[model samples]
Target chain A: MLLCLLGSYFFYGWWDWRFMTLILFSTILDYSIGLKLTDTEAPKTRKRLLLSSVIINLGILGFFKYFNFFIDSFREMLLTVGVEASMSELNIILPVGISFYTFQSMSYTIDLYRKKIPVERDFLRFATYISFFPQLVAGPIVRAKDFLPQLQRTITFDWNRFNSGLSLVLWGFFKKVVVADSLAPFVDLCFEAPETFSSIHLMLGVIFYSFQIYCDFSGYSDIAIGLARILGFDFPENFKTPYFSKNFSEFWTRWHITLSSWLRDYLYISLGGNRHGTFFTYRNLMITMLLGGLWHGASWVFVFWGFLHGMYLVVQRLIEQPFRSLMTKLRVPTILSAAMSIAVVYFFTCFAWIFFRAPDFEIASTVITRIASLEGFHPSTIISKFMALKGILLIGVLLIIELTNFRIHYIPLLVRKPAFRLAAFALILWAIAFFGTFGANAFIYFQF
Target chain B: MKQQIFSRVGWAVLFVFVVFIGDRAGGWLCQQIVKGSGFRYSRMYTDKAKCDILLLGNSRGLGFYQPTIEEITGKKTFNLSYNGMTMDLGKVLVEDYLERYPAPERLVIDVTMCDRSSPEILASFVPYIADSDRLKGLIRDTSYNVAAATSVSHLYRYNSEIFQRALYYSNGKSDNEWLLDRAMSTSTLKHTENQKYRIDARFIKELKATIEYAESKGTEVELVMTPYYPPFAKVVRGLDIFHEDIERGTGRRVRDYSYAIEDPSCFGDFQHLNKKGSKLYMQQLKADGVL
Candidate 1:
């Protein structure tokens, strides 16, 4: 445990040695708070302890990640009205993984306060839990209840686990380096100058951006989970073919399963969840999603992305019964209705992704207007036909694998069949060589 | 435990063996597709394409419009141009052409292709490396890592737009219809200012070498600057510098026809002409006795 702790710190500190102090400070604060909460039985004192843990951890996170954002937003608001404000912005470097670890530490304190999990007395084990390197930077956000017990047992090397884990890691690398990175250049060009490209290109760019972000982020999660499993630790699956979801509610459950579950369990339920009336239920969902969006980055665009999703959920709930009745009246086939729902869900998801990807509202609007115009919308008018063809081919390959994997959980099965494992592994290796764009592009979620 | 360990090691060996055999087999299949392709490069290397007039440039070279040129001049024409064809690759391709077939009566080059060097596109020519030592040497000189990658994985050689085009034309289709056929967008015409082209010194040297080699092989080499959108042409920077550099470097008089086509409907974008514009420009080339 001590060696694992050292290695985790070393891995993180390699980015910036100075940030090690901040992580150490967080670890010590949580450890002390965990002990203090355990010793006290008074409800008020426990509440204060939990509140203090939340405050200090959030305070550090806010100072690093959001101080400039709030200040600049305030100045902009002041300027919009006729008042002049001169707020000095700090030149602060956001410590990498501050958001991930801070939430992780807060989860431990919250779970302890609720008497759901025992307070871990050993500092080394607690620290290792918070800073486990595989998911440390970009996370499945492994919870304390899921991980702490496993740390108590001595782990042995197991061949079955190793084979399955290796399969996951290889699939993750192919998604990241081949599919995501290859789509990036064409997407970047379209987003940089939406007016310069044809309508078809801009439309293709938005679609590519959706898959690019999905592959890039989920690819990281797969690697983290696989690496954890290889080390004899099990991390929960973070994604489950999210684009295949037929409704916004199902989409949320499948996409970023850890973060959404975290928000639902802790934030939504805390805000008088669905036990209250429908109006308050809607309010809680909005507040949770808006905060969830802000949690991703300190930008209004991200907040608006969350807002669109909140609206999607609310609107879906409002109209779902009527829509189902209409479909029944029209005698729509079940498969056709399912296909339509998936298409509508995917379209709205891609639409919201525009705001998430665009630098600001102006660029987002330009992309929308240009695509809507449908000028030069033919395939032949696409400027980068080579890139377009490549992107389509790679996306096709991804869909084929995903569709097959959906029906058959092949990664686990690979452990049982030597011939199948060998063939699949070799094919992936060949695809990587033939198709990957290798410039050591960082995983997209590292910023969060 | 001992048997389990041996089994695992044996499986690992079998994995490597499978990978090696699969890579070789896949590469061989791709090579066959490329050789049987009707793509321009494939045709040239296979000794199936020869011409009285040869056209070369980047995308702008596609403006040569072979069908119109052939109709007007009553001569056989083959275009050796691909989009983003750098001067270094151009020299290798043309030298390879001269070596394989009889020297053409005329070799027309659009000098604008010397604007930059594209090692990325050069690496895409790996599928044709077996036919030309010059191409292999040039690719090695430009990027040894990419050349090494081709050696490591034969399938990697066919991993490019060049290979995609080969697959596209592999079904016995005519390759001459490969031209941009769209009208210029209003947005492009409105925002044509501030565009600049910087000439790479290495590309300039390669252009000079190509001219010398073509002339020595008894082919008359004509260098010309293709037309840009008229408004874009008026405001474009570095054209005079590029034109002068080409003439000075090659010691050949370059006919400047950059303003030949003036219709707004003739352009697909600021730098390239649509089929309408290419046809118009080809007429001018024939009338000027350059075809």
Candidate 2:
């Protein structure tokens, strides 16, 4: 994963050769320390060591990623005091995927400290597991127990696993190359200068972006899992048809499944969970989600994104009893109720994604303001510029793919007849080959 | 377990075979329909053999370089640009065109940074890398000495009926249809505004290859940096290091037309030129005797 991150940074022209070397040296030192620390059975000593490691990892992240953010915030606070104090800002280059793998690395010591898993004695295996290139950048956040065991075992090739893996990889490529990348042009056209676009275009852009992000990140996850499967390792599924999710709770369960679950297991549950009564439970939920949002980036947009979801969960919890009763009284059909819930959740999620997608709060506010305005209602302009017909068709196709099949695991079943399956596979491949954007567009989550 | 695995493998292979056959059949069917129409396969727009000039680049090339250049110059010309072509792949296209047609007297290669410098250019050009047989047929069909009847059969097979329908449905319009519509459209053709001319190291490499190839073939290659809007052009000019590197590497005179026309009225967007701007820009090029 470190290699992939470094490779991506180099490929993207975002970092210099020196930065890559620094990252490599840091990674090696961190890995060695991790291995050495794990070898001992001193619990109290391990606790101190783990705390120090957390400090060091977070210290690196804080300096590189969040120092500027904090400095600016502090500067703003100082301006309010009428005593002007400003510091010359250091332009720190954030190492790609530091937040992701930092948490991943922390999970190892945390797990070790909890006695949930044994410390890996083999330094190479331990390092490889942590920096396993496939899931290293964006993660399934492999547990030490789950991943370490697989690494320790002798890898034997399985044909079914290989076929399944190949199919997944192909599917991911299709989603990313064909659908996600195709949507990018329209999304970019609309969002480039949002002030010029109508509410309709702005709304359409957001919708396109929501799908683009899904296809981008989930596509990465699919490729990662597929690659791991090819190498005789099983990584967890990180997405589960998230768009079809019936509620915010269900959406969390579905979208970025690994990260959500990790937050649930490590952070939420650790913060007294729902055990400390309703008030504390709400507080815990907010805290977990706010941090989860911050985990995405140092930006306030991410914080707001996390806050919105956190709000949804809290509201859902508050209204659960009454809403359940109301549904029962209304005699709402199960499917209809589920659909309504999903729609509501999806709408809110899409709104929040604007913040996630926008460069900063100013752009986010502009988008919100434009969406609020009823001006620029020219349907013709929207139709011509946005390729409204094609955009709708693409969205329709994506929905059908998601809703009809919901489960990606069932894709193999669609090809019951070998001939039919082969034809479908070929068509998909040809489509991707001819029409797909196989350009060097990076996955969206690579920034985090 | 082994038996199960073998069975699965057998099925997968069979599936792949069926798909290939289906695709070929689909492609063949599409060829038949397009061939039946009176459309000439090579010059769906103009006579290939009669053309003296070719405009080649990506979409920016397509949208900017008006095919009327041929009429204006009293020379038959073709804009052979596909939407997203890079200089590296443009080499193959130039080679392919030369293989069939007599080398055009002049070739206007749009040196857009997005086209030349983007690493993603290869992916964009993958679709256009036609197979050897298809390419040979294209060359033969476009040749003047080829009798009408001999070319007809070759064109017929190349234009697959099923593929044509699929393309029409997917694209919602044919390429010929789009070309016709563009010709009739009242909307002004926009050239790049805020044209930044940064002759980076990468740009120099591509420029050398293009220039060397063109020079060898007795075709003069004029490195024209199409005008972009102000700030964008400023950004490009600001890259002193990149400019220095290009000058050091190529030893070629890099023309900067970005700010040559200062009137904002000539620009439609930050990077594209308005119709008026294009005329003025073309006239300036003519005055400079670069065309």
Estimate candidate 1's alpha-carbon lDDT, on a 0 to 1 scale.
Answer: 0.90
Error (Å) of candidate 2 at residue A337 is 2.1
How close to the true structure is residue A200 of candidate 2, measured as C-alpha lDDT?
Answer: 72
Off by over 4 Å in 2: A1-46, A80-86, A383-391, A407-409, A413-421, B1-291
Per prediction, fnat is 0.64, 0.09
Over the stretch A61-106, how does candidate 1's per-residue lDDT look in tens digits? Answer: 9999999999999999999998899899999998888898998889
What C-alpha lDDT do the candidate models reach, one value each? 0.90, 0.65
Q: Estimate each model's TM-score.
A: 0.94, 0.68
Find the candidate with the highest lDDT and give its number: 1
Residue-level error in angstroms, candidate 2, position A421: 4.9
- Clashes counted in candidate 2 amount to 27
- Stretches off by above 4 angstroms in model 1 are A84-88, A407-411, B191-194, B248-251
Query: Evaluated with DockQ, which candidate comes out highest?
Result: 1
